[model samples]
Target: MAGYIKSPFNYTGGKYKLLDQIMPLFPERIDNFIDLFSGGCNVGINVDAHCKKFIDYNDKLIDLLNVFKNYDLNEILIEIEGTIAMYELSNTSTFGYEYYNSNSSGGLADYNREKYMNLRKYYNNIKDNYDKFHKNVILYILIIYGFNNQIRFNKKGEFNIPVGKRDFNNRIKNNLIQFINKIKSSNCEFINLNFREIEPDYYKNSFIYADPPYLITNASYNEQGGWDEDCEYELYDQLDILSSRGVKFALSNVIENKGAKNEILVKWIYSRNYNIHYIDKNYNNSNYQIKDRSKKTIEVLITNY
Candidate 1:
């Protein structure tokens, strides 16, 4: 936990929050680390491995990581600061949760909305034109200032998430700096490919990790392209193949979430000779404060050692 680096972007369903419980389950010695669905790249970047490869279906995300690896931090920060100033937003100002609530609107809120829309439009244009540096910078800012700190794109492949109450604060800056530094220190490779396309036979002494979108849960990634039953089965099939070939892998998924059970995952895990480690996904301090706290979801880390 001391050196775990946070992903700069606040990705929904990201494994960063579960790292304390998740990290210890990884094999002590990992010659090569493979992240099959590296959404925010939180897992791969943090795992202690000799070398790492981050693969994902989203090309834009890969593009963002490429920008982080290649571009100068100062230049990226310059663009971020410029956008903040242009919006007349404060990095340290306290805007209560009510400001972001659906019911509240007036004064500075209106101005922020207008400014955010303009920035979003500019970002969409940059994305369409594929201007590498500025596009990545704008995207980063959007994550900082977007609703719920999420990065979402509309059906047209445009950045469409509305503005959030927050601004580009220190936490974001530190996370960005930490992410870049981690990339600099570690041997990392980013590839745009789906889970099935990855050939497991190519490497030895490697650990493959899959944090795919849950079939039963709803998320931003799920809406992009539905993670249906077929996709889930395909991933399981791939993992099965890897298991036969002596490839060690770990899969993070939910067994039951909000009364919706992942029957496929439940049945598959029961049938397999794998290690199932239950993860307490809740990070609520209230759970510690109050004696009786109901469990929200059942998260499990399935591993083929």
Candidate 2:
């Protein structure tokens, strides 16, 4: 875990913690590596491949990744620091909490609430016209200070998450630096598209890794019927197509969660005679908390070589 690069985004169901368990299972000599549901891109960024493609349905996220890939590290740091200074947001890394009369337990939320909202309003106002790099810088800054360090947008497509306790600290800054450096150097392309729309045959000698939203879990992406039974079935169908093309692929999902079994996933994998590699440890739950041992959660990596 210490050796792996972590994504700055605190994305739900991120594979950062599970990389040690997952990466070794991947093909040693991958010609092309495709991340089909690359939320936060924890897995893809760490994998070594000749070519990498990160595909996701979230256009905003893809845009942000592009910003990281296209901009210089110094430029990104400058923009982030400038935004923090401009918004009067707290920087506990530079100055301790005592500088703002706040403490770690309580956080700087009280002092940052009004300032954060103002910045959010300004970002929403110019989001359409602002420079792409600069606009995403604002969005990134917002997430740094936003609630739970999570990205959320309203129905109107506005940055709607409230101010969070944590700010852009030294640790987060370091993570961002590493992530940006990797993205800039890697032979990778980011695509915003539906997973099913990607043609499996196009990536003939490639390895695809799909970590779609788990059907049984409750997360922002899976809430409000975002992912349902039909979506699950459709994804399995796409994976089947990938198998037919002779593309080696790995899928990260849970067969059982909280005593609820994913019968559809179970039936599809077994019927197709796919390989199931059970994950010994239960990853984070819906709230990003570790699930208790009492809970029945069977996480697995279904692979087709």
TM-score leader: 2
Residues 1-305, model 1: lDDT tens digits: 57789998788888888898888999998999998889998889998888999988888889889888887777777787887877665545344435444222432344467778887887777636676787787778777878877977888889888877666656778888899988978899988987767676754668998999998777898996658899999999888887888989999998876557789998898898788998875544322223443434678999987
Single out the weakest 10-residue window by summed lDDT for candidate 1: 286-295
Deviating ranges (above 4 Å) for candidate 1: 93-111, 283-296
- The digit string of per-residue lDDT tens for model 2 on 132-242 reads 998999999999899988887877788899999999998899999999889888899999998767675666888999999999877877865678899999989888887
Backbone clashes under 3 angstroms, per model:
0, 0
TM-score list, all predictions = 0.88, 0.93
Residue 3 of model 2: what lDDT?
93
Report the error of model 1 at residue 266, Å.
1.2
